[model samples]
Target: MDASDGHADREWRLIREEAWPGPMNMALDEIAAETAAAGGPRTLRVYRWEPRTLSLGYHQDPDTVDWDHCEREGVGVTRRPTGGGGIYHDSHGDVSYTIVAPADELPGDLVESYHELCAPILDAFERMGVPARFAETERPARHQPACYLRELHPAHDVVVETDGEERKVSGNAQHRRTDAVVQHGSLTYAVNAERHLAVFADASVTPAAFRERVTGIADHADVSRSEAVGALEAALADWADATEGSWTGDELERARDRASEKYASDEWTRRRPGRR
Candidate 1:
């Protein structure tokens, strides 16, 4: 976790995980939230994967994906606690953010909360020289197979211009627990359009058909990942009273245990709704 502005006393913790499986990532966020409620600090975790993975949304069906394709390709798969759709995180194109904060710290309404968290991403795009905006209209139902595909009520859903045409640069989702809110999302830097198309063949638009609908910093703005990260830090700073901090060993242990027991369990992953 890199601190850009040096505001080092506002109860913020930065965690940069070295690419674990999908379940571990979700587990860490859950643990971080619980620990924060128990006097742990507000946290921002930025991470990537060694082997790429697919994360399905909480209400999404594992059967919706071509699991055999993923298995044959050795792609790691796990379900998110948040609602939306599925996302394929390949190494080159995606950057994931998990922001954990006390419920009181977030906006009261769900849409407002989404806008508040996504402020930094919008700022980052502008800093990179891309004029980005959030779509004010209601999100289309046709874009629901993936989070990026759908522009819901409050997502930042970074929109950028190309030859006067608008498209999406990034997308995100949120999960609210009693004490905390977890907002997780990905910024598309470069997309494997074909792979996404293959995964969501039943969707209205195939990745190949809507390649033009997506935008990325590499495609439009001349910026490095480090620059994007700097912009993100600045954007987050605008909304947060940040501080420098780390987790205790016990916290990590608890997160690991939860990852194994809850996030990694097939009963949790494959369970059907209303069908105990």
Candidate 2:
């Protein structure tokens, strides 16, 4: 894909798809990244899961999550290529976004890349009149286990102050492939903290120990779903020309095939033995 002016062509494609299973969603993102690299289009997708699901980080141990509990609770479990802790996704609490672009379209380094990608989220929150800023520190506090638990540098994260209390509202993760970079994250509007605690509370994780490590947007920013989406749209519009659309037949088919072959396999999901 050549931009006449030596800059990436500012094209944004937005997709809203019906709730899909975990592997399928991951596959679609991989496919989108490849498509974008081919100069097809820079794409953003918003999707959900039919049944609630738990997604673990690429290198995270599946055992870290209580699979017995998830299975009993009817929540599906899948792994993501990105590095981060696990996340629980429910209908009302979750909003996920995926950005697919050529490397040149982003920053020169990983840290800078995160900032460029995360700007829209910060802008969105600001548009909502929320005073959000990125955390300046790179070191994690003693008890912080997940990315969201501690603020890291260069990540386009959302931090806000309400009632004189500071908190984080959103966090993101990225996966850089040979062809392009795919960054995806969730803006947690609400969280079932108790449910998450219940699932994590076990011999491995104590309820009191993990409670201080997780948070949601509802904890700081008081905005409705429509408001949040609108803010995001406005913010994204400032950076690129967003075109609302759906996945093409070819893209969907490729994603489906990849999901079955790679994302659904235990070899890929449980790559490390004696871990899960």
Candidate 3:
């Protein structure tokens, strides 16, 4: 289906406002993808991280993580199934989302697929009165270890122009398998630079530098985190023509099992993608 089509022509399941630990969040997304691949309903969900969390990209170097700092600060750590640099998801400072459907149902080209899936994200920003769009040009990386600070690409990076410069507000990536695709991302509603930086092993990235490279919904719009979440949830639902929904008991059980086996396991988190 064309992503720009009105809700009258499409259907999806909407899961909103759930909060879970990092490992469970990742597992749930995986389960959602599996469900879609198995002829189940497509999903659009917005969720939060409890205790905040630092999520490493699928291929991100484990050595770039500051394990001691994360433990000391009570920040949970997990690895995403998608690829990108690390992202620090704050409990109240960020919003997270996932979209899952059969791979054949979306665009065939990778970048085009991102554009199609990210339509609701741009609409969400519009609903919150933030003028955000996909970046039109590439920007050099300010820091390679962080998703927001890495090189900006027009493919999936969302930005708002401020003071004549485009500052990143969101980063998204996709994990495509033979039968399905799962697209997930983090959008900043507020910045916690100190905590964000402390998750990385690099100590040279100052908060001022981070502020220059990244931005949040609160930066350009006077919207609270709760307000932002509401707008985003509404946007995703409208975009997908989705109905209010919840996980089935079996799905939740499967996600819990997957979390224990993969996301929460040291063998899965500490090694590179294929190693585990």
| Pairs with steric clashes in candidate 2 | none
User: Model 3 TM-score?
Assistant: 0.96
On TM-score, the stronger of 1 and 3 is: 3
- For model 1, what is the error of residue 113's alpha carbon versus the real structure, in angstroms, after optimal superposition? 1.5
lDDT of 1 by residue, 116-188 (tens): 6777677767777878787655546545667666654434566776776566777778889989888887887
Write down the lDDT of every candidate, Cα atoms only: 0.71, 0.69, 0.90
For residues 68-165, what per-residue lDDT tens digits would candidate 2 score against the true structure?
78779987767788887666777777777788888767776888788878877777777776667776545364223244444444366555654553
Which residue pairs show backbone clashes in model 1?
none
Best by TM-score: 3
For model 3, where is the 10-residue window of minimal lDDT?
1-10
Among residues 3 or more apart in sequence or in different chains, the pairs in candidate 3 whose N, CA or C atoms overlap within 3 Å are none
lDDT measured at residue 230 in model 1 versus the true structure, 0 to 100: 65
Per-candidate TM equals 0.86, 0.85, 0.96
Candidate 1: segments with Cα more than 4 A from true spot:
1-9, 151-155, 163-165, 201-205, 237-241, 273-276
